[model samples]
Target: MLSMKVLFAHLGREHLGVEYLSAALKRQGHETALALDPGLFGINDNVFHNARLERRFDQTRRVLRALEEQRPDLAAFTVYTSTFPWALRMAREFKRRSPRTPIVFGGLHPTFEPERTLRCRDADFIIRGEGEGALCDLAHALEHGTDPREIPNLGFRADDDSPALNPLRPLIGNLDDLPFPDKGLFERDINFRDDYIVLCSRGCPHRCSYCCENALHRLHGPGWYRRRSAESVLLELEEMKARYRFREVMFNDPILLTHRGWLEELLEGYRRRIRVPFRCFGQPALMTDAMALLLKHSGCQCVEFGMQTVNEDLKRETLGRPETNEQALNAFRICDRHGLPFDIDHMFGLPGECAADHARALDFYKPLRRLNRIKTHQLVYFPGTAITAEAAE
Candidate 1:
């Protein structure tokens, strides 16, 4: 086996995807390092407007210097649309400074916009979908001068040719097969105070028109929702407890209660093993008094409901989320009854959503807001989502 030093560049906040990939690579016996751009941590309400581009540029420069000093055989980058421009800049700088090092880009942006990602002057290759397997394969191929063109699920830029497209790899079937992400990768820098994350499953069951996960399913194929067993998830929790001493585990699952049986098993496992407080994202339809009580007993301290809008017409026709206002209110009431702190996520500026609709949503949540847990944000279109195409139209 060829040995190579790898640097994975993440210009974002604490992301489990990157952490998982980094850990997998290290377990494969390759030298790996991570460089985080500070700007990603500073993102807030005014992120798009007040983002200090120059400061991000400087931070990228510092990271590049560190990469050059380490002289890795390959450099990989993960980027979102917001950070794509800066990540591209860092990749270009790395290529210019170390012409021999190969640069690969991945993440949601690149996965959805492979052609655009490949158009980057400095990007040598782009990995679509998951990065753990693809990145490891690319690293091995690069280190040994193997033909990366043969690798599946990758797009590469070459001289005198358009981007070379490789066949798509099948999505991993047994999620339990993969090892837990290397937590040590970000142990030195990650602040778990306000941000703790866990992924109980991938993909979602609901086809909410505005959601990125729904778009992903449409683009990739249906039945993409795969979940790890309760035992598998509990093992991860045990690892987190042993390693990070985390106070809370936040389930990043797109929807945590899609399967009631799975939710029951997971809650039972948490109650048995973790015995620590946890939180999760929820869809209003799944909320019930019994379910809330079970979750609370199983250490759930908080829940976030995707109560996108209260306008009946807008909720059903525009967003394709058929949840009723009464259902949402009942869910919140369940949370209240169980003493579980709950936050309602409301999105404004959706297509055809007028000021009246926004105000109606506010009014619907106004009584619930007395608990001071309602959070609202202007809708932002993510690529490959139905709303993205709708916005374009």
Candidate 2:
């Protein structure tokens, strides 16, 4: 098939999803470009803004200007719930400007709410889970003037203009088969210059109630967890080191220490091949003293644990987390003993939380030597999660 350009529009932060999709498209002999909005109102995904103040610094026209310049055959968006409104507005504007070119929406929002997302006339198609193969198929079908209605993991308008969705395909069994994410798309965007980001794995092992991972697990059925081999990851980092000259590596995995054997191999290879300081997420149950020591020896800068609430009862009953409060505290102690700087994720506004719970949390964290941060997040009920259904009742 002849080459066709696919343009991805994203806002608020550097989208790793976009980079991966670009790599997939480019691998298939298709062209790709990015129309990025700096998200000036809120820097680095900390989205906070006043409507009046935000109006003065709207970057829509600038983004649209880039879209017009690129003039891509297909325009795509990687939508999150937080960015859905902005993406919709952008899509509508693009439709007004160029009605013939089709627009496809993919990512978290559209994956869960495909029918609702298709209600918007501008979004011609939506891809549910693991979009690489599905999107490539869609592009090829569109380019070759074939039927895309039968493609797996695709949602689109039917003959009668009602929303139609296809069945999901199996998860990508081997992550190493795909090329490293095409970070070149963000070459002009300055937000993610210092840190080289990578995801060694996809899907979390635990089914936390509030997290979207559970929703994803339901969508893909079984065998959702997948990780790249240590060699595959290190090779990518070596390429990145030569290209970007980054200062630090950020492993953006939900739990990097899930598989001890895989992690040990990766850490050992990382220390030998790439000695850069890196940050990653850990689980309270998994953050043992031995693991902490291994991380410290391998140039780990900071490890973050999701200690959402200190109340073990609330954690087990409400959040579906298996780790106990004692385990969480022990994880902290182990990190402190090993001189490993760590961060704890704390959540407020849990179902049964009161002021006393906050006081208890403070007491729990009163004495810690190597505590790097206590990141706080308010409870949000994402669509189709176990927590969201429970909250509605």
Candidate 3:
């Protein structure tokens, strides 16, 4: 097989995943480079809270120029829902400069809406779901004149009248097989002091109406919520700690403490071995005072609970979260007692949520505010989410 030069563009968080994939490709005897968009750096909560868009077109252009100079055979990009438009524009620009370079799109947006993404002239291919294996396959295919159609989980347009989607591949159950994301790719560009993120697992089991994870589950099958073993996760963490030396780590899993047994094992392992302060997302119902205390002892400095709203009727009937205000408040109190900083996640503009409901959420958050940080955000109606479908109807 011919060696290929590959460039991966990550427009969001510069974490282990991007680095891991790049390293894996390199290990396969391919040259790899990474371009991380500025937005992925930790958001300025102040500016973000104010809903300000700080567009650094010049910086992006400079990065694009550098990538163009590399003249990679293939350019792959991972785009989030909010950053899709900008990512599309960047892909277009990349294609304009290196028209021969195959530009492929992936991530949550492409996984769910491949047809829509294929419509963009710049994006020659879209890979859905877990991309480590698929990306390597795509790179090799392009380098050796292999057929793109045979690549699993890919979407492209055919000469016929319609877009073609390869058969969806099964989710990677043995996460241990995938190599840890390569941090060396961003060692010079990213500073863990300001930004740090990781993902121990993918997909969420909960079917919250407003959540997009459920949609991701439906995209493939019910078994989308897969995770790496505790040993596997710790290995990655050990490598990250030894290399990057991050003071803090943020697990971006929708719900890090989802599986009680797995979470306990993970926490215990971290406590015994690597004990860097960390934070993660959680649900109130799943978190007991004992678990919260264990997490704190295991170096968990913070936890962000998805309180969503306090309107009981709307919480249950509208968003399908079914979390009681008292339950959430207790969780916050537990975190406080354990001296773990916590953030209450609230969403605005839900279906049937009104000014009164917003007021109710504020009232509910009042008591918890003293215990922890409270955050409120406008509901982003993403494509393929239940709330989005409900809103359309």
TM-scores of the candidates are: 0.93, 0.97, 0.91
| Candidate 2 per-residue C-alpha lDDT over 1-393 given as tens digits, one digit per residue, 9 for 90 to 100 | 598799999886677888999999999999999888867664324556566656677788888998888999899999988788889999999988989988999999999889999988779999999999999998999899899889999999998999999999888999999889999998788534489899998888889999999989877876888889999999999998888888899999999988889999999999998888999999988988789999999999899999988888899989999898888889999998989999989999899998888899989988988999889888888887889988889
List model 3 lDDT by residue over 56-140, tens digit each. 3325866687678889998878776776886788888887888889988888888878888888766888888778778888888
On TM-score, the leading prediction is: 2
Query: Local distance difference test, per candidate?
Result: 0.79, 0.89, 0.78
Pick by TM-score: 1 or 3, better one: 1
Q: Can you give the lDDT of residue 217 in candidate 2?
A: 88
* Worst 10-residue lDDT window, candidate 3: 42-51
Candidate 3 TM-score, C-alpha based: 0.91
Evaluate residue 190 in candidate 3 and report its C-alpha lDDT on the 0 to 100 scale: 77
Show the colliding residue pairs in model 2.
none
lDDT of 3 at 358: 77
**Model 1 spans with C-alpha error above 4 angstroms:** 40-58, 192-195, 369-372
Clashes of each: 0, 0, 5
- Residue pairs clashing in model 3 are 12-40, 19-181, 19-182, 20-181, 20-182
